[model samples]
Target: MRTRPRGDAGQAFPIYIMMVAGLLFLALAFFAVGKASALRNDSQGAADAAALAAAQKARANFGLGFLNSLRANALDAFLIAPFAPPCAEAQRLANANEADTNSCTPTSGYLRDLITVAVEGRDPVDSPVLPGSEDKVAKAKATALIEFRCPNPKVIDADSNGYPEAFIFTCLSGDVVTIATADIERPGLWESVSRTLFDVRLVDQ
Candidate 1:
């Protein structure tokens, strides 16, 4: 039987190592992209849900009472509830060498802003210029921010040059919701107008 070339064995080891390294790199990239995408989706969904919740609450009562009520409820529901699980999950997934969950706390500032914007934009109404009109315009708005961390350090370059140069990825999005109601012509219209505005803002949030 013919013997294999003597030098081939030495060459084969480096090739194997290179192939394994390439595979690991690709895997890390895929994992990081997937994680970032998932987090982005989750954040956007949470924002939309929270906004809609605030808006719906405002719509029901059609006044400042509605917005105030929803704001109080949302303090517990949206801002705190959704984050608790992810905070724990982040800690569990963190590596010894990687930054701990403490780094994630800074992101809470964005969450607070998001919740505030959503609640504040809950209702805004435009009443008819003429008396005895049924045409009224209402509007609502909401915003949210999302951050994603990669499990593998290799995928993200902390010092990379780009718009967002940091290893971490952050995304922000805003949405507007609107509804209209009948306009009435009468005295003390401003009270009704203010109430409608509050309700509209709540609905949009």
Candidate 2:
């Protein structure tokens, strides 16, 4: 007959069970951290998209007013013009990314415009390690800038007041765009011209 099983082996079985339980808890905790990180990243991406969309919309809206200013021989007025609020665009983009826009603010200066947007993620952390993680959401903010690419205009013609009646702009891409005050009234002209004259980019808030 075999000798009785050792009592030492029986005692070690409980220790093994405890070790496995501890390890499982640690794994779940790590997984929870990773899920939280992913949620934050998604929130940041949504904020960036919302801010950029707002800035771009503001830049496009500037086209009509800018064209009108040029026609009036008041380009300087357009340079310091106020931007149309683009909060609606920001909201649309945030929703598309599964987030909500908490705030959208636009500020404009001489030839420069900036839009800042804050967003909250729709999904929660939802981690097993934290009791209330399912109710915890992520938030982030981003800013975007839209500025005139060419500050100086190469004057093709000047009126008595030294204002440009016709001008050539050397854009950042080294493309020359010529505009005459007389031809600015053509339909859909500003749409193409505005894209070339302005540049949009993300910026530190």
Which one wins on TM-score? Answer: 2
Residue 5 lDDT, candidate 2, scale 0-100: 73
Instruction: Name every residue pair that clashes in candidate 2.
Output: none
TM-score of each: 0.34, 0.88
Candidate 2 positional error at 121, Å: 0.5
Report the C-alpha lDDT of model 2 over 1-205, residue by residue, as the tens digit: 8887799899999999999999999999999999889999999999999998988898888877877776666778888867676899999999999999988887878878888999999999888879998899999999999989876777766767876678788887898898887777787777778778988889997
- Backbone clash count for every predicted candidate, in the order shown: 12, 0
The models' CA-based lDDT, in order, is 0.32, 0.86
Show model 1 residue runs off by greater than 4 Å.
63-205
Give the 10-residue window scoring lowest on summed lDDT in candidate 1.
Answer: 147-156
Q: Positional deviation of 160 in candidate 1, in angstroms? A: 76
Per-residue lDDT over 28-55 for candidate 1, one digit per residue giving the tens place of the 0 to 100 score: 6666556445544444343344543333
